[model samples]
Target: MKALIVYGTRYASTTEIAAEIGKVLKENGFEVDIKDSRQKDIDVEPYDLIITGSGIKIGSWTKETLKFLEKNKEKLSHKKIALFAVCGATRDDEKQYQEAQEKYLDNIQEKYLTKPPVAMGLFGGVIDPNAKYGIMDKLIMKMVKKDLENKGIDTTKPYDLRDWDEIRSWAMELASK
Candidate 1:
């Protein structure tokens, strides 16, 4: 099978996740192509399977990803789609994880796309203070950091919440279908 993995990310973490997904798909004997949404326009027609993901920012999926979905809705409707979301909310609490799924994944499925993903994942994200950010992002991160501190969560270090084993498991499951 041929698969296309497309991702949208602000700090590159989601892109890394996409690469890992590609690697796992390749290992499973599938032909795969991975693309960064910011760098290129994608045509889903050539692939039998499509996996698209995005990092959440201020309760929004990246604009590029949304546009790609909107533009390619017809093509995607005929293919098998698996969607994943990356956000720090999953690292907080069960309630937050539920909210993140509702906001980031469910909403997109219900309102944005013409086709529903056969499999969906809501995964943890990364937070790195040292990463470059624009003034607005910096301000938002300051507020986020303050909130974490208030909850007794340390903001002094970067947080990586991606679970590679879980990611690979998800990919393997998808590949078997």
Candidate 2:
């Protein structure tokens, strides 16, 4: 089957995860197309399955991914589709992480509840405090860092909490059906 993997990333962490998913899908004998959500236009009709993802920033999913879904809602409803989100907060609290996923899914579902996507997945994201950030993200990260420090949390180690095996298994299951 043919699949399209589309994503948006601010720090490039989500893009990495999306690419990994594409790789695993290809290894499982699926023809996969990986595209950045910033594309001016997209043709969803060409693919049998569509998987879209984006990085979460400040408790919100990227705008590009949301726009893509809204733009192709009708076409997506007719195809096998899935959604994923990548965020650093996902690693700290499983319940909160899941709530974030549900929030995004709810937004999409509210728009297309009559015809929802086939499935959805949530994945952990990478965090690099030293990475260049805009004024707002910088300030936010600084506060987060302070809070973590007050709680005696280590901030030096960069963590990539994504589960490649889980991603592979989900893609394989979708492709098999």
- Model 2 C-alpha lDDT versus the unseen true structure: 0.79
Q: Estimate the TM-score of every prediction.
A: 0.92, 0.88
Alpha carbon lDDT at 114, candidate 1: 79
lDDT of 2 by residue, 60-150 (tens): 7778888988888777878888877777655468787767767766665666434666767777777776677899999998887777678
Show the colliding residue pairs in model 2.
Answer: none
Q: Which candidate's TM-score is highest?
A: 1
Pick by lDDT: which candidate is best? 1
Q: Model 1: per-residue lDDT, tens digit, 135-166?
A: 99999888877887787777778878898888
Q: What is the C-alpha RMSD of each candidate to the true structure, in Å?
A: 1.6, 2.1
lDDT of each: 0.86, 0.79
